[model samples]
Target: MDTITVKRRVMMPIRAGDVMAEFISFQGDRSGKEHIGISFEGKTPSFASHVPLVRLHSECLTGDVFGSGRCDCGEQLDEAIDLINQEGGYILYLRQEGRGIGLYAKLEAYALQDKGFDTYQANDMLNLPEDGRDFRIAAQMLKALGVSKIRLLTNNPDKARQLIMYGIDITEQVPTKVHVNQYNHHYLKTKADRKCHTMTFDD
Candidate 1:
């Protein structure tokens, strides 16, 4: 695990209402990836509490920027912003695109998905790890933010496990809303069934 330190903090406003956001940068990240920590709090004075509700969101250009329905990244991001704004927390926007396989490989996996391969299977076909995200960075970010304990806002158990492994005291595991649609039904299913993400679909 890389030893990380707070490089800078910038105040910024986002689209998710009147929340107070402090974007953070880090130093000593071995990967040299620009991971950002967007901390939202104090907008609703009474909603702010002791323990922060933190979210570790990986980068997804296709889904987050273009609103692609092939996955729920964008929706989850939007939801995280709103919920974290209300509850008071941090959103660690990691630059781990396509589960750490890079954009092109992710696209290749997508091509394989079009041929009936599951997300993991497509990655396997590409000789790539199914999920190569390292949550140690997230833990380091939280530590830099002076947070040792958190109520994590995510459905992925792996996130919690990794955070715990990296010395983040997970006080609670908060599940995100399941965003399932025609374009991402199978994708979400693969996440739930194979990845063990906590997802319950509507009947």
Candidate 2:
């Protein structure tokens, strides 16, 4: 594993609902991009010996930031934050918008999904891989933060595999699920069926 040089650390605050989180920023390998780590302060230290409950959430501008109902990314993020606050953990907000296809391609995928194409098929049509995120940098960041193992919070199995492949010990897998809406039902199914995400529709 390569060493990550944290150029600087910045303290910032994010207000979500009634909760205000204090976060730290580390300048990552990429220039102009800083990895933000939300602090679970009190509860997190208790789980440090065990696997930290970590979440590697890819950037979802529409769903995460804009509260778009086309997917449950935003809801899941909120849930992760709340859980982490109580149980203690971290959220790695990767900038791999649209599963690493970037914003425009994700928008195109959204159009295709609207036209009845599932998420994977739409990305395939756009000549993009189903998921193009690389967790190597995440592993490096975790190492920098002194995290040796993690009980990851996610439905995506590939994320677990990728993190382990990059040498981060995965002690357990925790699933994150949100109730499906009319807009995101098939989209969620494609993630479960095609992407091998652990989400169950029965929930």
Candidate 3:
């Protein structure tokens, strides 16, 4: 794996309101995507004492920007900011939109989803991998930040598994809350059942 370095660091106040984070840009990212890291120093002594919390969030245009309820992406991003802020961590905002199938392909898959296909099924119909995200870059980002160990903040086991494979020491895995609603209930269920995401439905 090639070494990636921090290109820039700026104090950016996100929409989360009064939450200040040190936004970091990387140089020589193998993926050639404009991935970013948002760092929040741990406020509490207990949180600061532990390994940093980390979140590898893929890009979701519909969910993150427009607040679309079709998936939990937006809510998860928002939640990550607050949680990581309180617990000293970094949120690696990856540009692997739509599970790395790109925006257009994702929309096409969404059409299949509207036609009664499950999320993974839709991807299969489109001849795309069930999950195309690569966490090696995330590991590289952590290395650039001088961190080899972390308490990962995610429900997806693949994230932890991949990070471990790429030489990141995952001291712990923290599960995100299930943000299920009518529009995203089935989508979330498919993730829990098919993708093995750690989630529990109230229904």
Global fold similarity of model 2 (TM-score): 0.88
**For each candidate, what TM-score against the reference?**
0.95, 0.88, 0.96
lDDT of 3 at 54: 93
lDDT of 2 by residue, 75-138 (tens): 9998888777767667888788888889999998888888888888888898999888888878
Between candidates 2 and 3, which one is better according to lDDT?
3
Model 2 is weakest, by summed lDDT over 10 consecutive residues, at: 41-50
lDDT of each: 0.90, 0.77, 0.92
By TM-score, the best candidate is 3
Q: Which ten residues in a row have the lowest lDDT in candidate 1?
A: 41-50
For candidate 2, list the clashing residue pairs, or say none: none
User: Over the stretch 1-203, how does candidate 1's per-residue lDDT look in tens digits?
Assistant: 57789999999877754566889999989888999999886345552356898889999999999999999999999999988887788999999999999999999999999999999999999999999988888998899889999999999999999999988998889999999999999999889999899999875
Per-residue lDDT over 41-140 for candidate 3, one digit per residue giving the tens place of the 0 to 100 score: 8677594447998999999999999999999999999999888888898999999999999999999999999999999999999999999998899999
lDDT of 1: 0.90
lDDT at position 202, candidate 2: 70
- Using TM-score as the yardstick, the better of models 2 and 3 is 3
User: What number of clashing residue pairs does each candidate have, in the order they appear?
Assistant: 0, 0, 0
RMSD of 2: 2.5
Candidate numbers, best TM-score first, in rank order: 3, 1, 2
